[model samples]
Target: MIALIGAAVAPGIAILSYFYLRDSLEPEPISMVIRSFIFGMLLVVPIMVLQYIMQNEWNWRDGIVAEVFQSAVVEEFFKWMVIYFTVYKHLEFDEPYDGIVYAVAVSLGFATLENLFYLIINGTNIAIWRAFLPVSSHALFAVWMGYYLGRAKFSKDAKHERLFLWMSITLPIGLHALYNLIFLAVQNWLVVIVPFMLILWWQGLKKVQRAHDFGSKNLSSRPQ
Candidate 1:
């Protein structure tokens, strides 16, 4: 039980630490970060309810459509909701990178809980795979969502804000759906998985750099 708990938790913490460090220019308050994570954990309630409704009505037989709906849309939508209602407009969300920090907290919070249940049922042998895949993927999903959320929050131009606001939700949904599509199709896994991981990594890293750059600008502009 202890090992399972650690296995479930370690990935989320590692991912959280990575993003927290990325926002080194101006880290958000620990209280807010913890609050975001707790809110994220609560998101599972709405997600499960929505999935039950969708699955009952649609009945895709666990095919591509159902996979996308259940895994990507359902999960990302809840995570997005948590961010929008909670930290999106917080005063501490002054700089763009703050979005990344909060988003990561939320994502990992959900992911870790999910992991605990999964490992408890499936045993710890697959813990490594769970850590590498689902947990890390949640962070990547947060990266795409967070980058735009941060931009949208600080955006002065309406059009700019609108575009990023749309991106914050839609981009993750689209990418997540795509991943689920290929994940469900696992016949030639590498063909899709390789390219998807590559793109996810490339884009995720680009956002990290952008967030870092924005943080730098904020620091330089502030009065010493």
Candidate 2:
């Protein structure tokens, strides 16, 4: 029971840290952030339920194509859509980095629930592995998605704007699919995926820094 609680709660805390860090730069009201987190989790529940059904019906042995399309594709699509339609337009999304912030929130929300389910069924050891790697990977995936979303939000060029928006969805989905494939092919190779996750963390940090710099510049230029 202690292990189960840790497995369920730890990822949510880790993902919440990203928001707390971002809040340091451009502080959102705690109430708003809490609302966003809850909403994000609420929005993804249907997708999770659907995935559960599909997994039982088709199973991974069906083939790579089926697994990718039915599992990874379906899950990522719904998560991304929730961010794009619901969170993207929120007033709190005032800067480019806001994209990354909110995207990570939604992704982590989905991941937290998914992790809890897996941990409950599989047990503690599997939960430990998932807590470190897959949970972090989902956070990284959101980082990139938010990076492109920031670009799309801030870009002046119409073509570039559209490109960034599309890339925001596609790139994360591709990374997510690849991550799933790697785990599917050789579960032992998760150690190798750690470096890729590190790269993603670096990328997310860069985007956040860029957004901070941009906001700083704008503030400095404003007449008092």
Candidate 3:
């Protein structure tokens, strides 16, 4: 049991560490990051309750509707809500990269608990794939979410702010839906999912770099 829990949690911690370290110029307050994570963990119950209601009330347990609306939309929406409300306007969110930092913290928090639950119920045989797939995917989704959100936060134009904020939710929903769709529709999901993940990772890294660069510039431009 301990081994399974460790296996489930290790990937999320490692991924969070990687993103947390990427904020080269100024890191987010550790307290804020932790608070975001706890908010994320707390999100699971509400999300589960909502999803359960949807699955039962609307009969959305399977098919495209289930993958898109039930799973992807519901999960990403809640994660976005937590980030937006909790730390989006906070003083410590001065750096653009701070968006990624907080988003990843929240996402990995949810992912870690979800992974633990899956491993415990389903046994350890799927632990390896769970790490590679769900855990890593959640981190990547958060990258895109944070990328646009960082832009939103720092932008001067209200239009840009609204646009970026909208993208912060819609983009992740699209990516996440496609990910779940692959699992549902593909016959040999492994082949398709690997390439999909590689693409997401490449794009996610680019967003991380751009946000990091923006943060450095934002810092330098400030009267110090």
Candidate 4:
């Protein structure tokens, strides 16, 4: 029970951070940001259901190996698809930061739902840690994915645009897979997991700042 509660904290902070950051960006109206968050949250229903089905159907003898690949494919694919199909065309996605905001929102939403389920089944003790770290890590992964995506969407340089597009999709999926692999390998090392998650969050913050800085510069350089 305690663990579950702990786990929930991470996602909560990440979600809140995403909204706060979105508010800081001066590109779109508050309503648009809120709408995106809601949309991102809504996407979790289908993703979770699909993942559940896949996991049950594709059960394997080795838990670690099975979870690492399956979890990555199920989570990353759905989150990316939601951002691409729903939020990408929205007017709110006017700036590069918008991509990161939307992506983080979606990722956090998925984490929230997943966390809730794990907490309920495991109890509050387990929930606590999950709330703080895994959830946040998921958000960080989304931020990394979103940064590149935002760059691709807003970039005028053709080469940069393509590079960003690929990174946007690949980076998050890769990181997510790596995280899963780590969990599979080190299921009991709470100390190590904590530091690793912190590193992921730190990296995410850097990515967000970089995207924001780049966007600001581009916006300023545009002709009046």
Candidate 5:
């Protein structure tokens, strides 16, 4: 049991730490970060209830439409709502990288709890893959969402803000949909997911770098 708990939690902490540490300009308060994570874990209940309703309605079947529209859309939408409503306007979200940090906290919170449930039922054998795949993917998705949202929050142009606001939700949905599609449609999904994950990591890293750059510039331009 201890091992299972550790296995489930370790990846989320690692991923969260990686992004949080990157907030070199202004690290968010640990309390806020933990709060975001708890909010993410709380999301599982409502999301599961909604998915259960969809399942009963036959709208969440194991098919393309179900995976994309039902699962991906529902999950990403809720995560987006949490970030937007909860911390997007907080004074602590003062820098670009802070978005990534908070978004990642929420995402990994959800992922870690979900992982714990799966590991409890399936045992620790699959923990490694779960850590590498679903857990990591959630972090990557948060990166994209956070990147655009940070931009939107800080943008001076209304048009750009609107564009990024939409992108914050839409982009993660699309990527998550593709990820779900591959799992449901492909026979040998392992081969495909590897490359897909690599691309996702690359994109996520680039966004992190850009956010960091934006933070650096923001700091430099401040009335220091």
Candidate 6:
């Protein structure tokens, strides 16, 4: 049981640590990072409730649209909410990279708790699979959002800021929906999934490096 819990948690923590390290400038307050994480953990309830209603009551669970919306749109939206309310306007959010730092912290929190529940019910037999697929995928999706989020924060122009913010939310939803769709379309076709994850990892790593390289001043690298 201890091992199972550890196995469930390792991926999120490891990824969180990696992102934390990428904060090249001053790090944000640990308390705030932790606060972001706890808030994210708490969001699981509302997200689950919303998804449950959509799946059970609304009967959207029968189609691929449901799979995409419920998994990608719903989860990402709540995570975005957690950020917008909790850390978005906080004074500590002073730099571009801070977005990724806080974003990953909250995301790992969500991923860690989500993983615990899944591993608890399904047992550790699938632990490896969960880590590679769900846990890591959550981190990547957060990166997708965080990259744009970071840009939006330091964006000088109001229109650029709004565009970046919009991309932060929408891009992740699209990537996440694609991730879910790949799994939904073909069971046990990890071959297809592995390449997709690899491509995402390449893109995400660049984002990570960009965040790492961000100077004390905000760089104006808007994505096209």
Q: What is the lDDT of residue 79 in candidate 6?
A: 92
Quote each prediction's TM-score. 0.92, 0.84, 0.97, 0.83, 0.97, 0.93
Clashing pairs in model 3, backbone N/Cα/C closer than 3 A: none
> Mind giving the per-residue lDDT tens digits that candidate 2 earns over 56-128?
7656446576557765677667777877887677777766777777777777777777787788888777876
Q: Clashing residue pairs in candidate 1, if any?
A: none
Error of 6 at 192 (Å): 1.1
lDDT of 5 by residue, 1-224 (tens): 89899999999999999898888787899999999999999998899888888877765666776888777899999999999999998999998888889889999999999999999999999999999999999999999999999999888899999999999999999999999889988999999999999999999999999998988888888896
**Candidate 6: Cα lDDT at 175:** 92
Error of 4 at 19 (Å): 5.2
What shift in Å separates residue 41 of candidate 3 from its native position after superposition? 1.0
Q: Which candidate number maximizes lDDT?
A: 5
Model 4 Cα shift for residue 67 (angstroms): 2.4
After TM-score superposition, the amount by which residue 109's alpha carbon in candidate 5 deviates from its true location, in angstroms, is 0.3
- Candidates by TM-score, descending order: 3, 5, 6, 1, 2, 4
Task: Give the total clashing residue pairs for model 1.
Answer: 0
Q: After superposition, how far is residue 63 of candidate 6 from its true place, in Å?
A: 3.0
The superposed Cα distance between candidate 5 and the true structure at residue 113, in angstroms, equals 0.5
Looking at model 4, report the run of 10 residues with the lowest lDDT sum: 18-27
- Model 6, range 34-92, lDDT digits (tens) per residue? 88888778888788898889988988866687868988999898898788778888889
Better of 4 and 6 by lDDT: 6
Q: What's the lDDT of the predicted structure labeled candidate 5?
A: 0.92
Better of 2 and 4 by lDDT: 2
Better of 1 and 3 by lDDT: 3
Model 2 scores what on Cα lDDT?
A: 0.74
- Kindly report which residue stretches of model 2 are placed more than 4 angstroms away from their true locations once superposed: 52-61, 217-224
